[model samples]
Target: MSDVTPKHAAALVALDWGTTALRAYLLGDDGAVLDSRASPAGIMKLPAGGFDQAFDETCGAWLASHPGLPVIAAGMVGSAQGWVEAPYVETPADASALVKGIVEVTAANGATVHIVPGVLQAGAMPNVMRGEETQIVGALAGDAALEHEPHGALIGLPGTHAKWAFVFEGRIERFYTFMTGETFGALRDHTILGRTMRATAQQDPDAFIRGVDTAKDAGHAGMLATIFSTRTLGLTGQLAPEQQSDYLSGLLIGHELRGLNEVLAREQSNLAGRTLRLIGNEALCERYRVALERFGCDDAKTVADATERGLFRIAAQAGLVRAAVRVN
Candidate 1:
């Protein structure tokens, strides 16, 4: 009711509200990014109703610049912790089902706003994911290599809680989330690992690969034994304290790979002739690729910024924006 009207009614605004920051993208009808803005407001930072204020401040800045453009958002912003708790649609959902249109939220000034719903997976066990679904779908759409193929694709999204999903015939068939990064953080920083190693030694690729190989060979139960081996190796003058982080990284990555392997094996019969794609941080993707290769799946391809590209593609398919946006 502030009396501001947008220059164009059809302009689309896409927001990626993450754990640490809030980012907004202004897109034209063709999905081209016209302008962008961001702020320090993230859901993790604001444990309370802080999201409402953060969102208002961030989007207010964008509205101040564009006058009155309709906005659509995805990610943790749709969770119970966000500005408005948008419910999640189950997996194997299509673009139409997945694309929960803008839910009108009232701003501090009484202006109307909208939020996008996250994706949830259910069965004997229930699992949920926010924000990454857009990216997963977007990654599938952007990769023409995937579209040309007829079979389903296995996508791995690495993060604090890494997600692995299957996309078939333009729908998300099923997915799983692993608390790899979070577990690593907990074990390294909060546990005995932190006390025994330097902060900077956590990312050694050699150690990571060794961990994957160990997990691939021994399975998850073997992690405790392996973890203790690091200490023993260091005590025996066989492994350095700096190398202790690598040892820990190996144990965690290995455990995660073991679980992922089980998921792949169960789904393999259903996927007789499909391809696998790894999407996440470059280095992490490489780690997955190495682990997967040992399992005899040689066709895994890796891509960067897959989530952003995936979100853009979903927006395009929903007609929220046009398909001409270059998602680089």
Candidate 2:
């Protein structure tokens, strides 16, 4: 642990600890971020018995600065492979359900840690989501328009496995997952298409736009047949090698947007014409926005750092911390 002094007493500590990275945030009494620390100690990065040691190394100083400071974590840190398996909270539920599902552990020095639960949707096509649930909670909690929307909101959290949640009132009604980003990665790094795709293939706007158009035109019925066009376009001398990556990105994201539109239309009519509030990093959200606009869902907005907002709300609701911010 680095020897440093905290400028402000931390009201609580929040973590958006996931599969590949761990980010910690120190927040004040008003739920505003104060300071933060980070580590590469994602669950996958730690050894069998290293979670405790890693936590101590990363946040022990903050803990020392504020004894018994409540720590609330969300993401794969609560997965079966994490410190403790915080079970899934069923859908058609609210943030209260998340608070109810929290699983805790005690550090050797006696600090308490809370792991937020993932959300599960059970039905013909079941779906599960972890960190994204908290992002959704924070997004809704931070936006009064969304928090009080009469028709509810459609939340799209784009990442490796993008999650589309339909939140009505204050509860998450249901959600679906699209492995769009992961699929793009696989195609770019492991498949034959990668041979022609160089690093310069990213941000090729023309190729990406074409890919989105192809996905929309193909719809779900022809999706299985559409991806091959990435290679065929190159073979036919239509797609340049440098544009392959961007093209592939467009095709997959297009497929995701199209699938989301169809699923929402079929599953719930109330979502028609409503905007999708996107929660994620700026780049991915922009990509989704382009596809959504091309696919006729024009109003897509982005909310950065929803993960932090959510951790604060969950901790406050659970009485793990006292923040003056209102979360309804």
Candidate 3:
């Protein structure tokens, strides 16, 4: 085989193969995103060993246009359910330890490819993360706040499966995962809450504030009773359908906030002295900021796509691409 030519050497591709979508990002050596392509070939939609075909079909056309560019994949594409399983590396492992090259997978059409690895946690009840870790790394890279105080920052990533990571000395020290989104979905759609609450209501900030106050005072032990109150309130004609949804949202977000509050209280006793950064969708982050303020922590900020940027940072740090590059 001959050496990679100048054309190949000039550019690199980073694949953020999420569970629901396959995103191909073309980045220059300086880390700027020159172009991007996306498809619905997420791992969740594929069958066993389905990534081989999905990745090829998704990227083949693009690769044909720009031949010989090396691709580095991250996220669910490296899971046991993905085309290739890149086993998890534990906490404190640097970008290089988790860095994996192409897996040389053979597609149905005989095309070759590669996949990234997920990070694993070791303990009695072991935990693991596939693609999101890369995003967290990317977020850390872009945030001067996180970079400066790498040892004592708590990151809240809100989504279906919200992730809270503790970074110490620029390495992931400890982290916890919560099924906030899944739980809320189950409660709203599958439980009694669905009957009284409409999913389309605009969240009422007043109700949300009430819920936060209740959470800080009542804690998780009172959640079930609080949840049932929504139904009771409707029966008594005290809560409207819109208010019911707000109540439920408050209950779930409050539960999450309480859990996080406990962690923060224990982790940082001097809460008045430090700042807690919240990164996620703007709307959701604002809601969280309101809740955090209710608990006496007034300093919070929300930023969008912190995860994608974080993942890109990890890719660059791992030598998959050039560092300090900004992707449009």
Candidate 4:
């Protein structure tokens, strides 16, 4: 058993335990992903005392093959409602800070698990994020140029709650969240606006562009009135029912970008010429890029796989992996 363990002992297991899904990666000692698997055992789905069984069921084979497999997890799995409530680390912090805030727990399978803490921005307008922090760490590590920039980099992560962050010197100076996606979801599914909009897998770029343009022209002050235009356009025969959803999507995303512009202005940072690094999946990042370009920020670049790389980087910083081993 000991000899078998040494043959394919994964350096560590990285888990992205989010609100609705759980993804696991078996990484080699050098930070390369050896094998991966996932399950629907997200924290939200677990009943009382179910996390241990769920985890063991998901990765029991790997755990048995490599005794005491060190597991590092990020995302809502560390939230107050997660397996163990990992606390939040304040901003102006870096990857090291994230590693330091890790909370350890013994899983039902007896595997040593470490949960990465979320990041918080305190004061008048308080905001917090859980899993996104690890992705930020990975983004900065992947793009070294952003860390040394004198003015810092503006990173936009689009999702349920899109995050706009200011990173400098390998630390998150401050960040803000916009409920653009969630708002869009609610309006499309629960409000009258959804009734007039058709659901289709293929998005209409033309309609989306029109919405982005309108949003940029209206600015932040016009958001209240701008959203109403979704229904008004359809009523007036200006917008097709099938195009309404993409149009609304553009409008909300535009609002988010415009709001971010305003925040950057207040902070005296220029978004006109600087290249903005957008970290997320290709589809979402493409939408943000389009909106940003329409809003006069043309240098938006999308990066994929930042989350996986981030998990590896954070694990290395915590000295969790000291040597390489084969993984089948």
Candidate 5:
């Protein structure tokens, strides 16, 4: 709790705990943030005392001050490696489904922490997510289009392992995961592509767009054939060492979009008129916006405050928070 948190304004303590970081939010009844805290204490890198200490560091004081504050958490904190293992809710699920899958863990402070479950898309190409499901809930909590549109919505949460979730009538019908950022790191740090690349403080937009254009024009051969150009272009003096990184980034992201485009085409649709939103880092989302514009989905916009809003939304769904009064 900081000086910013006004006296007794918090209605819920929400946490968005992930693989590499932990975010704690003190939220109001209306889903507004009253105060917040963040730590590098992700699930894998907890300190000597582990999850209890990590939770206490950010939330212990708040709980002491405001006894019986409703607490809810999302992300890897609820994974198999986390404090408690909440089972996965299958796809075509909604917030209500998440409520049905909630698991309760009594924290060190004796306060019950409700853990939100992850989503599993099972079958031949099985996929699972823990934290991103909460972000998706945050993203779609109060969107207007999802209320009336049959076409639904698409949200892109870009990161080391980027997840693009598809929502139709408020249910996550399906989604895709792209290891673009992780693969980019491995290629730039471990692969032969690292041999000719230099780190740059600034991004090379021209080189990045060049790689994207190459993908759009000649990518029918797929990424395996195109990624080699990152090295050859630098060796031939066509690309500077500093530019190769972003160019490779563009190449990888371009292929991702290309695959997404293929998926859309299979559904008799394209990015041209899709209702899309991006919920993640602003700068990375900006890069995605640029790449997406090139791919014809020009209307994508980044959303803010979705995590806290999502936690509150699910809390309300689970009867942990009182609903706001509505009048006709």
Candidate 6:
């Protein structure tokens, strides 16, 4: 860590380092982005002793320039196999819990990088998340209503493993994991359902909605039972090859939400009228929005730049950025 910073504007350097990709952010005093960077070098993708190299390559210059400008990293970079394991904070965990669980990795030059810990909901059916904790914090930062939603809000992070976190009073209460995205990928790439499917750049919203409606009406039989209809509809000419992929995607996502609603119903909480915030890619969140509407959920929106905001929020919590004001 050398003192090479030019303007001294950057207050923090944050990294959302996950399984397949890593993104870095330089934040100002107000948690605004001053600069940013990214790479494909995730923890799982790194080679032997490559973490140091990847770290240096991705944000070395920023760190070099800022010297001790607090560096904070979230995601798999803090997992058991990451640079250093940051232990999981249990459910009902808040930003304070994440700060308490922070672990550090020291560079050869004695620079310290703070790694944020993941959250775990311990129970018979245990659920865990790493990088998403930061995203959740970011979502909360973006919306005040979600933090205090009377019945708690559902924050959906849709991807390979979709996460539905139930937030109450600015804390992560409990969550559910839907393997919807990954299942769709497997069925599309390896299963017979993929054989007749054709890839296209154009989207078929009609076909997608149809699949969602079908899932809502006939999904009570369970996922495995209704999932097979994807191929049948195609075989019967109701779904074209080009429409099969999107249809299958809709089916999986629809089923995921259906299950989520059911689980909420069991807990005396319901998703139908709940305030839901989604965090993920634009198109994917839009798709989930449509599916949620189909399930009678009228209030759902996407939170942009959740990861960056969450990283900064956590960094500030850990006294890494935005130094506290002292009373005169």
- Compose the digit string of candidate 1's lDDT tens values, residues 1-328: 2325332333566788877888877665545466677887888888576766776676666666555555667888878877888788887776677665445577675545556678778888877888877777767765776766554666778778988877877778888888888877888777766776755625666665666666667665666666666567667886667767776766676676577666667745422234677777787777767666655667778876555565566666565444222221
Instruction: Please give each candidate's TM-score.
Output: 0.82, 0.91, 0.83, 0.93, 0.94, 0.94
Residue range 199-254, candidate 4, lDDT tens digits: 78888999999998888887556677798899999999999999999999998888
Distance from true location, Cα of 18 in model 4, Å: 0.8
Which residue runs of candidate 2 sit more than 4 Å off their true CA positions?
A: 1-9, 148-151, 267-273, 323-328
Query: lDDT of model 4 at residue 164?
Result: 87
Candidate 2, residue 10: Cα displacement in angstroms equals 1.9
Write model 5 residue lDDT over 72-128, tens digit each, in one string: 999998998888999999998899999999999998879899999999999999888
Global lDDT for candidate 5? 0.86
For model 2, residues 48-115, the per-residue Cα lDDT tens digits are 88878888887888888777688899999999998889999998878899999999988666778899
Superposing every Cα of model 3 onto the true structure, what RMSD results? 5.4
Candidate 1 lDDT at 278 equals 76
- CA lDDT scores, all candidates in order: 0.68, 0.83, 0.67, 0.84, 0.86, 0.86
For candidate 4, give the lDDT of residue 155.
85
- The segments of candidate 4 whose C-alpha lies over 4 angstroms from its true place after superposition are 1-9, 323-328
Clash number for candidate 4: 0
| lDDT for model 4 | 0.84
**Model 3: how far is 198 from its true place, Å?**
2.9
Per-residue CA lDDT of model 6 for 201-234, tens digit only, reads: 9999988998888788888998888878888998
Question: Cα deviation of 307 in candidate 2 (Å)?
Answer: 0.8
